[model samples]
Target: MRSLDFPALIYILLPEVFRIIELFHFHKQVNMYESQITLVMDTICPWTYLGKKRLDEALAQFRASPSSSSISFDLQFSSYQPSPSRPETIPDRAAHALHEKHNDNEEAQKLFEEHMISLAKPLNIPIAFTGPTGNSFPAHRIIQQVQESHGPEVTNKLVDALFRLYFAEGRHPGEDDMLIEACVEAGVGEKEAKDLVGDKTKGERKTKEDIRSIGMDIDSVPTVIIEGRRRDLTLTGLKEVSEYVKAMETIKKEST
Candidate 1:
């Protein structure tokens, strides 16, 4: 009877211990999520700011799930100039002008701002529409310099700074100091940022030329292009998380 009791105890205790260990491992995996996203943005677009915030929340939710079907990914940054040819003092004249032209006609700009605020509320992101419409050459050039040297991660940091400054703080994105500050905050050397902006006469034209080479239409600020096997996916305006996730899933499946 004693010998039988010992083996029974061993079986019961071992299974419980194994179950506990399994639960811990499952918890850890559920908390782990590795994925990447590419955000193509122009600070002039309030929707871009809102879209990014929502995308981040969605990605966070994805990471919190424990599905073996899910794989890790990265978020990459892409450049888009909404008003590539606007003067330096104003960065987003096209969208604003369209808004003003509509005066009493349900202004698209007002509609966009309202939508951005609503979308941003859930993610604790704030956006306003007081920035000037102007050239993005100075800012893009700094980003280009970062991309050329430190790579996309650096580009991402600068992009984030731009969003915060324009959307939340209502700062003019075209202001050289604002851009320089964002660069420095992102670990860009002050001298390099200055050099990029200081050489704006040559730099601005070259920046526009470089942006044009990407071959994207300059009609909108937040253009997201996801390349796939069947076709290239292009999204403009403010997008929801579900939309981005659906596109990402399609791209992932095609690649696999």
Candidate 2:
């Protein structure tokens, strides 16, 4: 009873301290610049690659402004498998496979190809999808390892390289040689990267589990998720850069 006052004051002050800490965190989130943008993408998605390039351009423009010139953003790359558990050979020959599937209606395939070509035109990249369309699970598993061990910057670089290899160059990204080349390009330890490719590590398992937990049945590539107040805002399929720009602005405003 004699120490009741002190105990009461301690309890009161603890909540106040927590409030201050919460306020500090809120402010920090609002002002975050260079490290704010997180790109959750899949290697197979063409539009994710295109959307990211466009988003990066917009961010560059933002950074160029006199007031925000010094501000940099944190670009974090996350994993998503558009076609999980699919056959490895399918991706290697995506164009042929898809074309054959749509053989009854040539326009069905041509229309899709036309969209891909248009997206690549602005970036001065060409895609023929001549090779394999293998399962991305193994490759995505490798990506998880890179992100865990190397860091976000390394992951981002590797992701960009993979995107270029698969979408622009139309190579089989699921191939070991191609993936190793991408890892090396990102400055990752080549031997370590290769070893971890199909290791069934915790991170890889978690990524795959998360994708399924969300119940996302992705039929196509380039699904972009914009983290919003309520949950994630998803952009499915190939979208114009302008749409991404608008989405970014909305996220910024929401943060405010």
Candidate 3:
């Protein structure tokens, strides 16, 4: 029943007021939208590699911008096989395969390579038409395993290493040596890398399931699907960095 002064009452309630404000902010953060980006691609595909690079650049730019302060992103890679029937190990016949795909037209193959090289030059990605071209199943399996065990950051590194190994270094995708080297480069221990590479059957079923899950809708590589709160955005093939940024902005707007 004792009377309290204004300053005493204010002091007594200040801590509770701060606590309430903290709770409010925490709730707001908890409810913030997260966009999930799934990149459906094949390791041997040059266009998918370019698409991944462009998407990475776009995500970096968007994260650095003021408008993306409240947005969160989760990027994941899905497996796709352009030539599912190719053997796990094959000789270096990429050029021949390209020519065959182009109906034995050398000019068409040359033009295709030239266009890819031009696009890659600006991004500093070395476009090579040489390397073992065959089944990418083992490579996809390793990627899926790494993603499951190490999460997205390490998986991204592994994917980048695999791309560089196959495209830039002209290494075989499904070879044990190549897989071990890529895993090591991505920060996986050498022993684990070897073990993972040794078991070719590991992650095979899941990888195949993932490929099948993509279904008939995505009949191409480098297809990116952005899952937003209200709607989803699908981007097929390689796109400019600005375009990816715009897509992120659109998702953010819809989220709010």
Candidate 4:
């Protein structure tokens, strides 16, 4: 009666051991890849979509350069909700743009749309803003869940899907079903993903705290940061491709 079952106790503690291994493996992969890039973005954000495309272009150029081919890239994602508490059931996007945060002026709406269209053209993003613009809190949770459970590559896939679904394709990220579909496409477990989306404020609270810790709060989406051994660079919104290239170059130089 005094002695406990050692084998049974070992099984009970196995999951925690696996979690430790997973964390170790993820960081191992990151170190192997050599660069740590964190993108803090909202899913339903148009400018973030453009930012993603721009970042991709910059990375392609950076990698194609003869001197930098040896440097591998690891893109980590952080969540940011500029306006997390907006209504989840808005049926129109343009109206959301006009009412939710922007002033309720007709001309302001037109300019927003016009600028979006111009940005969409370069990447050939088929965005019409024809449908609803739902709340972004759920999408952030899914991205964070994948990043924490899976890895940066898997998380990048989910973030890409969310942006494509919300901006290029005609789907609102606020819908649970759409988010579940996105998770599945990103190689996330469908069942577990639903549970993640159901829980609010899990991932984004830490993102908010992270931004605050650095003495700056997130006031916008698609904020990309390159952290190096000796320096760090930050960019917000749709920065030029050359600017992104410069950021990566700075990181590489500092890393060396």
TM-score list, all predictions: 0.69, 0.72, 0.88, 0.77
Evaluated against the true structure, the overall lDDT of model 2 is 0.69
Best-performing candidate as measured by TM-score: 3
Judged by lDDT, which candidate is best? Answer: 3
Q: Estimate candidate 3's alpha-carbon lDDT, on a 0 to 1 scale.
A: 0.88
lDDT of 3 by residue, 1-256 (tens): 9999999999999999999999988986887787889999899988998999999999999999976766788899989886688776668656656655787787888888899999999888897888676779889999999999999989999999999998898888888898999999999999999999898778888788888777557889899998988999999988999999999999999896
Total backbone collisions for each predicted model: 16, 20, 0, 0
lDDT of 4 by residue, 178-226 (tens): 8888888998888887887777667767755654543355578788988
TM-score ranking from best to worst? Answer: 3, 4, 2, 1
Of candidates 2 and 1, the better by lDDT? 2
Across 111-135, the per-residue lDDT of candidate 2 in tens digits comes to 8778878877887766666766677
Alpha carbon lDDT at 160, candidate 3: 95
Please list the residue runs of candidate 2 whose C-alpha ends up more than 4 Å from where it truly belongs after superposition: 1-35, 66-72, 91-96, 99-103, 198-202, 216-221, 228-234
User: Where in model 3 is the C-alpha error above 4 Å?
Assistant: 1-28
lDDT (CA) for every model shown?
A: 0.67, 0.69, 0.88, 0.77
Residue clash pairs of candidate 4: none
Residue 75, model 2: Cα distance from true site in angstroms: 2.4
Deviation in Å, model 2, residue 145 alpha carbon: 1.6
Lowest lDDT 10-residue stretch of candidate 2: 65-74
